[model samples]
Target: MEYSKKTRSSPRTLDLNHIENTLSIILSQVEEPLPTITEIAEQLKINRRVLSRHFPVLCHKIVTKRRHYMRMSHLAAIEQCCQEIKEAIVSLQQSGEYPSESRVCELISNPGYFRYQQVRLLYKQELQSTLSSL
Candidate 1:
C-alpha cells in the first residue's frame, strides 16, 4: 500500500480595523488636489481590488461625500469672493473711481471671477424679488 501526503492551504486573514484606519487616514489627507484611488492604494502598499473588498461602501461613499463637500466649499468660497468684489466696488465708488473689468480681475485673482459675478447677480435679483414681495 502507498501513502499519499495531502497539502492544505491557509486562508488569508484580513485585519478590518487596520483597513478602516488606513481608509480614514487616506480620506483625511485628501485636500485641494484629491488623489486617485489607485494612487491612494499604491500609497497604502495595497491593490485596489483588496481595498474595495474590505471597504466596498466606504470606497464609494467616502470619496463621493468628500467630493460633494469640496464642491460646496468651493461654492461658498466663490460667494464670499463675490461679496468682497461688491464691497470693493462700493469702496471704489465712494472714492470716485470707476470699477473696470481689468481692475476687478486684478483684485479678485480668481480665474472663475466671472462665474462669481453671475452668482452675485443672481443673489441680488433674489434679494430684490424678496424685498419687493414684502
Candidate 2:
C-alpha cells in the first residue's frame, strides 16, 4: 500500500505596485480620514509587518496624514468653540447679564471648552474687549 502526501499551496503574492496605487488613492481622498497602518493592512487582508516591510514610505505617509488631520480637526473645534463663546457673550450682554464661565459653558455645546488654554485665552480676551467697550 502506497501513501500519498498532500501538498499545501503557497499564499498568493501581493502586487506591490497595485498596493502603492491603492494607498495613493486612499490618501488622495479629501473627505475620508487617513487610516492607521494596522487598519490599512487589515483592510488589504495582509499582515501589518509585511505591509510595513514592503511599504515603509506609505506607512510613514499615513501616520503623517493622520497627525495633520487630527491637528486641523482640533484647530477647527477650537475655532468653533471660540465663535460660540463670542456669540454667547454678546447674547448675554444683550440680555443684560454678565458672561461668566459657568454662563458661557451653559451657552456653548461643549461645556468643557474652557478646559483648553486657547479657549480660555480667547474667552478672557473677549471679556476684556467687552468690558473696555462698555
Candidate 3:
C-alpha cells in the first residue's frame, strides 16, 4: 500500500462542511444504495486516494455484506462537532462582529470558512483515532 509522494503534497484546503454534510446525507439514507468511493471522488473531482486520506471517517461511515463498504459510526464525534459549531455561533452573535442575521447565516453557510482546520484540530482524540486507522 505504498503511496506516491504526490499524495503527500496536496494542500489541506478542502471544504470540511461540504465533506461533512455530504457524508451526513450519505449515511442518513440507510435503505438506499450509495455510490462507491471511486464514484464519490469522481463526482467531487478529487483524487480518490486524496479524499480517502483526508477523510477517514468515510471508513466509519460505510457498511456492507462482504465487509468492503463502510457505515457511519454511531458515536459522539459528530454530535460533539455540532455542539462546538453551535457555541461558536453563539459567540459570534454576542460579539456582533457580523451585522444582520442573514450576514451571519451567510458566513456560517459558506463552506470556505476559516478556523475549520482549527476546529478539526481541537478534536484531536477523534481525528487521531481515525488517522491511526488510515
Candidate 4:
C-alpha cells in the first residue's frame, strides 16, 4: 500500500544547429582570444566528453584555430617588444646618451620584454650597431 516518490532526472537536450552557430560566431572573431574546447563546452553548459563526441570536427577546428592564433599573438608581441627596444636605443643615441640596459629598460613601454630572448638579442645587436657607428 506504500508508493515510492523517487524521480529520475532527464538527460540534457542539445541542439546541434545552435552549437554550430555559436562555434561559427566564435571562429569569426579576429581579435578575441580563442576558447579551448573545454571552455566552449563549459560555456554551453555541456559535459566536455559529450561535446567532443557530438562535435568532434568542430572541436578539432577550434583547437587548430586556437593554436594558430596563439602563435601569431606571440610573434606580434615579440615584434612589438623589439620595436620598443629599437626606439629606446635610437632616442638615447639622439640625446647623446649611451643606451645602457638599465636606461633602455626604463624608457621602453614594457621592461618585462627583456625576458624574451629575441628582444634581448635585438637589443644587443642594436647596441653593437650604435657603438660601432660611434
Q: For model 2, which pairs clash?
A: none
Candidates sorted by lDDT, descending order?
2, 4, 1, 3
| Residue-wise C-alpha lDDT for candidate 2, range 38-101, written one tens digit per residue | 8888888889998789888888888899989998988999899999999999999999899999
Ten residues in sequence with the least summed lDDT for candidate 4: 24-33
How does each model score on lDDT?
0.67, 0.89, 0.53, 0.87
**Candidate 2 worst ten-residue window by lDDT:** 25-34
Report the C-alpha lDDT of model 3 over 21-105, residue by residue, as the tens digit: 7766776665545677677778777777776777777635653421332223322444455455455455654675532334433
TM-scores for all candidates: the values are 0.59, 0.81, 0.36, 0.80
User: Of the pair 1 and 4, which is ahead by lDDT?
Assistant: 4
Give the per-residue lDDT of model 4 (tens digit) for 26-112.
Answer: 877775579888898899988888867977887788788999889988899889888989999999999999899999999987899
- Candidate 2 C-alpha error for residue 90, in Å: 0.8
Evaluate model 1: give its TM-score.
0.59
lDDT of 1 by residue, 1-134 (tens): 97768667675676779878877766666554456567767877778888888788777866686678788888887877777666655565566666555555566656365655675574465445544654
Highest lDDT against the true fold, candidate: 2
Cα displacement (Å) at residue 12, model 1: 9.1
TM-score of 2: 0.81
Give me the runs in candidate 3 sitting further than 4 Å from their true place: 1-12, 63-134
